[model samples]
Target chain A: MTAANGNVRLAARSLAPAVLVMGKGGVGKTTVAAALATLEAETHGLAVLVEFGDGESGRRALGPTHKGVEHVVIHAAEAIQRGATPLFGSATMAKLALGNFAMRPLLKAAPAIRELAMLESVRQIVEARPGVRVVVDMPATGHAVAWLRTAKQGREFLGSGPMFELCDRVARELVAPGRASIIVVTLPERLVLEETLELCESIALDPGLEVARIVVNRVPLPLAQECLVDARALAQGGGALAQPAAALVSLLEARAAASAGAVAALEVFAHGPHAIWQVPLAPVDPSARDVARWLRAEGAA
Target chain B: MKDPRVIVCAGGGGVGKTTTSAALSVALAARGYRTLIVTIDPARRLAGAMGVPITDVVTPVPLPAARGRLWALMPDPRRSMGTFLDFLFADEPEAKARMLTNNLYLGLADAAAGVHELVAMNLVARAATEGDFDVVVIDTAPSRHAIDFVTYPARLAALLGGRTVAWLAGLAQRSGGATATAPRGLLSWGTGHVEHLLARVTGPNLVRDTANLFADLALVRERFVALTRRASELLLGERVAYALVAAPTAAARDDVLFLAARLEKLGRRPRAIVLNRADTQAAPWVRALREGHGVAPSITEVLDVLEQERRTRATAADALAVELRSKLSWAAVVRLPYVEASAPEDIVAALSTELDAHLTALLPDAR
Candidate 1:
């Protein structure tokens, strides 16, 4: 794990084939991943960004495609339909339609098995579509663990089988350094930081993947020391609410310190080269254009 | 089975079951019925929705409505397992030890996905059969696992019986004994390990005297049958109404349909569908302001778009309502406006109003 700057430099130069953007749900992983792919496409003129997941959140976030950047949204269910063909080739397309009549009961019988089948189907896509930057908006933490563990499950259940062999190989390739990079997006909050660090540790254990950097979204802007002092004095030198002014200042200072502590904790836990970028919460929902501008200005992507 | 004393809500993960359960329990309790909401998801979502800090212990919390008292508890399978072991062994140390040491027993208990449901069901059964709450509403795991949860004990018992039935029957034939002996070698060793574990956990006399606990298949079969039937009745009874919850998205609507069909197969009928974030036509004035931007070709086109939006909402709501009514003897449609905030108060209040008319008849005093 290089320093955050070094890793970013490495990523910019090498531009790994597969990048998995992962985080706890609702932490702006989708936004950041889309921005990264869009920026890479615009700046260096990449051909396309293949977004994989149930939500197709990246495709939604990135908006319509442009000349340099074409977005291919691969829904897992659709991918499952495609992948099941080679295995269940004799079956009709209707039989393989993800939630169709024939497949529904079998899929429901064992959920873990269904998930494994879907993931392998995904791996098949990754195998076919080479030489492109594919960004997987991986499921949130718990399900991400489940996704990674699918190979282990396959090995256990179908030892020496082709499905098991392929899953194991794909799992090996994914966890390998330089093959894939994992970006852990999180808010600069204590619990989120802890989970992010735990995730990093799990990735570290894999030996194939690297914790690229931590993008801390929705951070509050800093107040200058002089500005705060002036505000304190003005409040103290005031009207009917003057008496409680000192207490209010103390509360505000505590909150400010807590926010600072969150960032510091992330820096400490993120031992590898890690960039801590923050996005100020806009009063109104930020437009995709505005979000892109902020990303570039903040040097997040 | 009309107006059965308990309602078990079952569904898959990430669905709005917890929210539905909390809102329903709050609604029922507000109507002056004592209600308990049970859940298992460790997200502490139910607690957060109910405005309680994360705690495993069950405690009553006052809802904002009049005469309302809703208690919430998450299913702790490990603790439930302990209580179940204690109950099975009659609090005897030897019996507890045998169960603990037995490979098959421990494997079935720990390795099985549906065992959590079994233990939780036991707790639910005890509450419904013993506790005083008029209704025990379960916000089940998502529909994917809901069926398994309700049928687990029966399914597991049947599976085990199938595996051992022939051998047990042969042993009964040979020995002229109603209580068939444990099969020899690996099977006997496994059973002995279980017996020893039970003896150590529950006490030696428990193992010696209660050999029939495992040998007599009838006891296990009887409990499973009773639990399955009771749960099925409570879940599917005419009075027990399942509210299919989904946000207003095409994907969600599809999932709700799939979930409703699955639940119906399991004998749990969905009496209503709540479109959680259903979009209503923006005020005509607001639409007029947008249309007046000089971007539109004609008045007809503007009216057509607005008409389309309104018609879509009407059709979606109507479709869901009709589907539910067709499947269930009683059904209604409830639509809630999409709110930007994810606050509990907003969700609770929104759902409460939608449920107002449907829940009126089911209030405790009505019974």
Candidate 2:
């Protein structure tokens, strides 16, 4: 890894036309994507924000800070609601009617429709703000793989249509170099790191999309060296009860150390320059205030 | 108990099946029916959508609702499986306890060994048959093997101890039978391996019991087959309506179509389609901004922004509508607008509008 400021930047024109954020759940993919959007919108003065494939986790996370940026959350049901109108009613009443009539049935009827609909939403946002950057807080590894693979499946099954076109475009966007960067977010854990590497392979990460970086979130820093030594020695001379407690502390320290190693291995796997910023685990669930502060700092950075 | 029936929701993963089950149960309750949704997804996401934490046991509490009660339950499969084993092997509690703690059982059970699907299906069938709620909706696991949970018992009945098997056993057991003196066949070798493995793992009594369980499997299979037919009737019955839940993406649509086609093959078509997170335009009066740089500061930026927003809304709207029109013609198509929160009230409200749309669509002739 290079010094923070030495971070390799994607060439604007040559970069992939999109950015893909890959990670396990709760490793702050949404937070980082939101932060990137915050940075783009505030510092760069670009119209930008993150997009989510399903539900509204991303939108909710970015809601308060979505000032200059547009946070577009897409799903099939939402798309249909936007499409319908009152033939003989007010917009409110018409939406109410159509929301139940035209949209709801459509929502329940198809799974591919939801994904295709979301892609369409992404396309819409991109076309709307061509110059604006889009940070997608993409689905978890398994779901994201399914989402990415949909394009190949579509080309085979759906033949040609708007849906197929959108899938092809998204696939091209994903594969195109410098157009997009796949930032794999993870915590320093054997399972998470292993999964990250596996995800890279499953998603065809190597030699295709440049993995921009790996962000290991919520890592607890080790205690002082003396404290760790004391803890380890005490652990060795322990009674049964004391051993568990001492072992726990040792385990935690080992985990923190291993997290760094995991990051190093990722650097080798990526074969590209990356950044590793240590995020301390929150003491409590983040209130909106905490999120706002974090957002502010990220924006400034 | 006005329309006491169950809606067993099943499908592949990442298809929004969980969300659909949650919303539909809420919708039925909103229409004045006491409803419950039982979810078996490992993520326990249904509770997140409902704004509550789920416990293992049944605990019905009133939600902020539309004059009716809706309850949600999420069962931990490991716990459920343990409880079930305790019940099934009541005579062998010590062995059951050991099995629960053993590494092999842990691996096998966690691998789910297809047992999660079996247990989930069994629970749903049992719950539906033994419920007082106006409706019971089941959200199954995402595996394609999920189908086997509902259909396997009958499928394996022949292998289980059927009457034919009983006759064959009786014929084989005949004293001085020619086969008894004959050389061992492939079937005997396979049974010998099965017997040896069963003895090593579960002991002679358990092996016998398991053999008996297989013998009784014919009964279990018959019961499951009957229950499946009953479930189909209950779901497709006029009082109950099956809705296929999907996102509007190509993959999600294809999954739904796959599920719908499967259901059609089973003669159990869904009654409606609930499409979540439909992309709608910002109100016409809302001011929009441009993204890129341009020198002349032309009106093109303003027009371009408006044009983009219009196109975004139009593209999403047209895509799902065309799918619904072409494919799910018999079903009502309800589209839910995206809300920026996972709060239950927010989801319920958004979903309620979609449900209302479905009702309107279903009653189209009324208009």
- Best-fitting candidate, scored by lDDT: 1
Kindly list the per-residue Cα lDDT of model 2 for residues A75-113, writing each as its tens digit.
556653432221212456435443432123323422444
| Tens digits of lDDT, candidate 1, B1-367 | 2133655554433335567667777777776777777775535556665766544456676557625557766766455566556554553566467667653343234333554555565566566555567677777655444655566556545633553333333333433444545556434434433332222322232222223234443344555566566656656555565666664433345556677777767766565566654445553333543444332233334334435545565556556555555654454556654322234555665566556556743333443
Model 2, range B1-367, lDDT digits (tens) per residue? Answer: 2445555566544445666677666766777666678777645456655765655545453556544477666766656566556444556555555555543233233322334445454555555555567567667666433444445433343344333334223223332233444325333433433322222322233223233333333434454355445544444455554566665444455557777787776567676676655545532222221221221233233334434634554466568767776887887666665332223455555566466545544322312
lDDT of 1 by residue, A5-94 (tens): 344445454535667777865566667676677655655566345555544455556766544555666665565555455443334532
Per-residue lDDT, model 1, residue B116, is: 54
Quote the TM-score that chain A achieves in each candidate: 0.77, 0.71
Candidate topping DockQ: 1
Question: B213 in model 1: Cα distance from truth in Å?
Answer: 20
Model 2 RMSD in Å is: 21.5
Q: Candidate 2: fnat, from 0 to 1?
A: 0.00
